[model samples]
Target: MTQATPQAPAFQLHDEPGHLIRRAQQIAVSKFHEVHGRHVTPIQYAILRTLYESPGVDQVTLAQLIALDTSSTADIATRLEAKGWILREVLPRRQRRLSLTPAGEAILQGMRSGIEQMYLGMMDSLDGTEQREFMRLLRKFVHLNDQQNKPVDTPTKG
Candidate 1:
């Protein structure tokens, strides 16, 4: 019989990307539910808030703004439209744009306080300096990671 190969040891705490991401998502989801109740998800609220801030934004732009794939954005938009939370309108010679309906606005208004509280709670453990540094590092990491996906020869100037 052949000898068996040795198995590799598992990664340490800092090296576990999947575990870290999952744990972070779990904590964030629980905190979000605590703030917004069980009805709304963080993603749904995020899309709604984006629409609220920039009314009539195009779906393509929205997808880019939220860092989601085109298909995922389309799915979310379709669901929100069905729920009467948003209106998707197509203008002549232009792309489809998204706008918040009155009901959507009303729901968002009700969620504003809780959302703010959720933000506060998420960072409750961090002092001002730590919060700022954490935000800075997270942004830097996302920016660099996104850069890796950029197409070569894309114009630098608008």
Candidate 2:
């Protein structure tokens, strides 16, 4: 005789917004990897994309721009540097600035189509209106919860 599956808790994971958001993130990451992992990780792509628009930004600024912690940002930068996609230099006041090398720009150019497809695929489940509304609501959610959702840049001085 086949055994029946055990019942889950009344509060199912699928009904949770946080769980759903995380699942959505996983899906996006999978698509991102499928299209671009051979060339660069998602965070690296964010860094490159930001640098393309705002070159010569400092590490701290770049970290905030991508909503990543400074340490993780630095680590990713190290890997990107090794890949010859970025250059980091220390300036006065111990600030480190990041710039995209020509290689970085070219690689980003190559990945543009894949990136577009990844975005499209991720939102393909929604109709055009739903997609726009979904994005708007997500942005609003972030704005409303930014203080809690966003990582603190630095400790407040006493």
Candidate 3:
């Protein structure tokens, strides 16, 4: 007689950390769009905000600061330039330095209130202490995992 096939362990999708994180991101994006409209995306806002704060940061460095890949950052820069919200200046060696334009600053200022509302709406369900604790834990989790996902300048042969 043939032996019975072994059963595989069950997996719970809803209980997975990645699933929860993705769901949270979806909610955050939805809230952002609701508050800010679809004119600017979350990534675009991040890039705009970073450029506003840093001013004249190179493309690669901007990518690193925003935790985005260079290709995507370049694409976003092109889009922002097209929108007249930012300037991408070419430096020596083909590096592009990004700076937010006056229009970008104006848009950011316009969205300031909505941004605060979006954040408040997202965390409204949590109490003050819980919100702080949640933020702390989230930062801790990202910090612990950051090294593993950081882009390597040179590829390894392994």
In terms of TM-score, the best-performing candidate is: 3
Instruction: Name model 3 segments beyond 4 Å from true.
Output: 1-11, 147-158
Query: What are the models' TM-scores?
Result: 0.82, 0.85, 0.89
For the record, the alpha-carbon RMSD of candidate 3 to the native fold, in angstroms, is 2.9
**Total clashes for model 3:** 0
Model 2 lDDT per residue over 1-158, tens place = 99999987789889988999899888888899987875678888899999999999999999989989999999999899999999999989988999999999999999999988998988889999999999999999888877646777998899
Clashing pairs in 1: none
Ranking by lDDT: 3, 2, 1
- Number of colliding residue pairs in each model: 0, 0, 0
Better of 2 and 3 by TM-score: 3
Candidate 1 to truth, TM: 0.82
**Where does candidate 2 have its weakest 10-residue lDDT segment?**
143-152
User: Residue 112 of model 3: what lDDT?
Assistant: 94
**How does each model score on lDDT?**
0.87, 0.91, 0.93
lDDT of 1 by residue, 26-113 (tens): 9989999988897777888888999999999999889888888878988998988999999999867757899999989998999999
Q: Give lDDT tens digits, candidate 3, residues 37-116.
A: 99999999999999989999999999988899889999999999999999999999999989999999999889999999
